[model samples]
Target: MKIFTARLRQTQFEISAANLAQCPPEQGVEIAFAGRSNSGKSSALNTLVDHGGLARTSKTPGRTQLINFFRMDDNCKLVDLPGYGYAKVPEKMKLEWQAHMGEYLEQRQCLAGLILVMDVRHPLKDFDRMMLEWSQHQNMPVHILLSKSDKLKRGPAKNSVLGVRKEIKAYGDQVTAQLFSSHNKEGVEQAREVLANWFGFEKEYETAQ
Candidate 1:
């Protein structure tokens, strides 16, 4: 299918929500990107949309402590969820963030799919497994991006992807994975194809011959 990647460049920041109550109206499809702190989530998102400053990357681990939404169109959006695990925040604040994220995951009706980003060097930590289990329970489709692939040699990066696939096989075909590099733009098109498919844009274009 031909997914117009150019349209993704049009994505603009819509709003930020500190809690579930602060989110916009739930009327459209939302694809959320979730990962632990310093997992390169923001970089991956910025690269995917071909925009340098769309998702707001930072040197600090816990800088993105709110739910940031980017509107792709009238009925489509990309959500950057608060980073979890190892953010230098206080225990009480971390707990509050976790509660908010949990509520957003469990209660959001418009969430079409999840793009779980993980650092290739540190794949599938406790946070990642928790998300996998939750998505499995909810029967939600998840596409895992082994981000920062450029940091590793090709052999190890490919192995990481293979290992993750084997580990998540029990969760069924709804869960998929791929190696990605925001720095080098490796696998950007592949990642975008997954987004296009999940966003239902594949139906809007004719299949490639």
Candidate 2:
């Protein structure tokens, strides 16, 4: 399958939204990347786009505090959502972030799908389940990335993928998953294929082939 070799390479940071009203115009398709803090969400995004600094990677968890938008083209965009389930922040601030996230997920008209990143060793945390349930309720499709797979043995990494696939089966076929490791470029093509399909770029990729 074709990777994000063309269109996605053009992604550029567009806006950062702290609340729903601050979001850009609700136009075109957008797929959101979300996971718990320190789950390697930003790294996975940079890997997918083949841009080292496209999405900032921080050593501190919960550094991405706003909903950041990246424009791929006129018809497609990618959203880097604030990570959930970090305790370093104030409870009130966490609650406010949760509220804004909920509002965006439930009310965003342009959302086409969700990319749920999870650390390979700790897949499916409580917040991950909550996100899956919410997406299922919204009838939105989800693609899960088991990030940081390079830290695990091959057998364990495969097992983790299987375990997550089984766990997410309750949400139906709308939720699909694969192993990923930004450090070693593992599963980058597979993740890109999913994103391309979600954004209706499969035909373009096929045509290019």
Candidate 3:
């Protein structure tokens, strides 16, 4: 599949936009990754692309302060948005990020979908709910990743996924979710499959061994 091949190929670092005006041209389909600070967004991106350093994982929350872009191909890209709900950051900076993200979500025509990362132990925080509501208003599809699932046992992890799915049902069929763990690489393929669909990637069977 081209998507699988693109994942294996080197993913180029595109640009970091501090605001909508600084962003690259809105051309092809783009899938954005967003979540609260300390939500494992960087780790999930690195794991999703099978590249260790594709997205920087920082110990400190709110370290990612810009909209980082990774080019999967000419027609497809992945965006890592600044994390929200980080109280340690300056209030001014927090408001700036909030404004930037809000404008991008509302006005970016090339945005195809959103992949929201949340800790499985604490899913559906206020910020997450707000994002869902905004996406619903925009008629945008969302695929949530319940990160750090390996911290919980299989039963509890499954329950968390079910709980999130149930809660999002109120938002209609546009929202979906799944359990994920970057450490064990759980749900990597599943996440990729969902992303591939968003980008309209067709699986190539002839190359199969």
Candidate 4:
């Protein structure tokens, strides 16, 4: 088949919204990347797009407090959601963020799927389970990116993947996962293929020349 890939490399910073009302029009396919703070979500995003600085990576957790959007083209976009489970934030602010995120997740009609990132060493925490539950409620397709796979040995990493798969199996086929590493670009192609499929990129078989 002649693969028609989404031009993710050409993605540009679009806008940041603190609430759903402030976000751009809900028209295009948007795949959102979400995770707990310090899960390397931003790094994974940058790696997926082959852009070093697409999403800002920070040593401090909870750096992303807004919903950031990156435009791949006129009809496709990628969203960066604020990281959850940052302990230092005030309770009021945390609740506000949660409300905003919930609003977006429940109301956004054009959101195609969600990329849930987690550190390979600490996969499926309470926050991750909460996200999974939310996804199940929404019937949204979710791709779990087990980020920072390089930290663990191959056997352990594979085992982690298997464990995650088993844990999420009850959620149904709408949810899928794989190990990913921003540092080494592991599973970048696999992730991209998922995105491409979600975005409905053209797939045409090549005829005999």
Candidate 5:
């Protein structure tokens, strides 16, 4: 497998719908991450690129309100979507976010796949399950990344991964599952391998392609 040399070249952020609306259309392979608030999504992104603080890491939930795009290379983009499950936000705002995210996922033409990050301890919550269903319905490739696996014992991490994979298989075969831990650097290479496969993929995908 090829190791991405330029992991992440730069990162920029926003906090508004209008700003996200202005995003440059994806011209190359794009892998986006979506997950619940405080789920260590940012940490996992940092781990993928071996760069801390490129995307803000925080204890506060729902800090990211816009679709943040990080440039990985000239041909690809690593997307960090806003976290859901925010309670302090207003009800109307929540509805708008739902619509916004739905629209983006439903129609993002260059999106090669989605990396759904979840806390290994928590695995798939209610919202995560729904997103799984959504991806299944769209026939999009979805990788369930069990993030923060360092919190679990080794045996527990393996069990958590197996359980998540089993449950997601019920949803569809489009799902691929793996364990991850930013602290331990577990699954970093695995994630990269999967993304590279997708990035280089063409229609009627086969490993040969």
Candidate 6:
């Protein structure tokens, strides 16, 4: 249980498209967490780096209206894309999400990879599919963390991961299928290994740890 430590670091809200576009300039490496509304994305982020409650969690879907950025040690950034599948938000607002996310993913240069987290029991919904397609279109690397896997039994959980792996294989992504749990800290180390290797810092990470 020797987990890594990442403190609050710095968190800044980006409201306008202009601000979001300018975020990646300084952050040496960037990894993003994206999924449908209320998909446990924020919780996993807080758990991953041992920073509790980093991103706000809400029962209300689509609450994260803008792309929020949190800096770590002034070296890397954690990008939180807005949650899709809004039930109460206006049409114009939902439209804005599509445009904002589309622009960011397609244009960002320092985007090392994306953590496409999905609920294990209900992996790869419609909006998740669209996100996968976008990643393929942009040729972006993706690491899929099947969040909330602790809720499922061992047999079903592994089966779900296998199922998603087979389905998204055609995208030719350097993808991984791991189960995550904030409550019990499952998948924490494996995820760190994934990110460290993806960003070419695994050697340093291991050496330091």
Tens-place lDDT digits, model 2, residues 1-209: 43456778889999999999999998889999999988999999999998989887799999888999999988899999998888888899899999999999999999999999999999999999999999999999999999999999999999999999998899999999999999999999888888888887877767888
lDDT of 6: 0.76
Candidate 3 has its poorest 10 consecutive residues by lDDT at: 200-209
The lDDT, on a scale of 0 to 1, for candidate 4 is: 0.90
How well is each residue in 40-85 modelled by candidate 5, as lDDT tens digits?
Answer: 8888887777778877767788877777777766677777877889
* Poorly placed runs, candidate 5 (over 4 Å): 1-20, 201-209
Off by over 4 Å in 4: 1-6, 203-209
Please give the lDDT score at residue 13 for candidate 3. 84
Q: RMSD for all candidates, in order, please.
A: 1.9, 1.7, 2.5, 2.4, 3.3, 3.0
With candidate 3 superimposed using the best TM-score fit, by how many Å does residue 102's alpha carbon deviate from the native? 0.7
Backbone clashes, each candidate: 0, 0, 0, 0, 0, 0
What's the lDDT for candidate 1?
A: 0.92
lDDT of each: 0.92, 0.92, 0.90, 0.90, 0.78, 0.76
lDDT of 2: 0.92
lDDT, candidate 4, 27-96, per-residue tens: 7799999999999999999998878899988999999999999998888899999989989988888898
Give Cα distance to truth, residue 68, candidate 1, Å: 0.3
In candidate 4, position 74 carries an lDDT of: 83
Q: Residue-wise lDDT of candidate 1 within 14-46, one digit each (tens)? A: 999999999999977999999998899988889
For residues 15-77, could you state the per-residue lDDT of candidate 3 as single tens digits? 999999999998888999999999999889888888888887799999889999999878889
> Model 2: which residue pairs collide?
none
Q: What ranges in model 1 sit over 4 Å off?
A: 1-3, 206-209
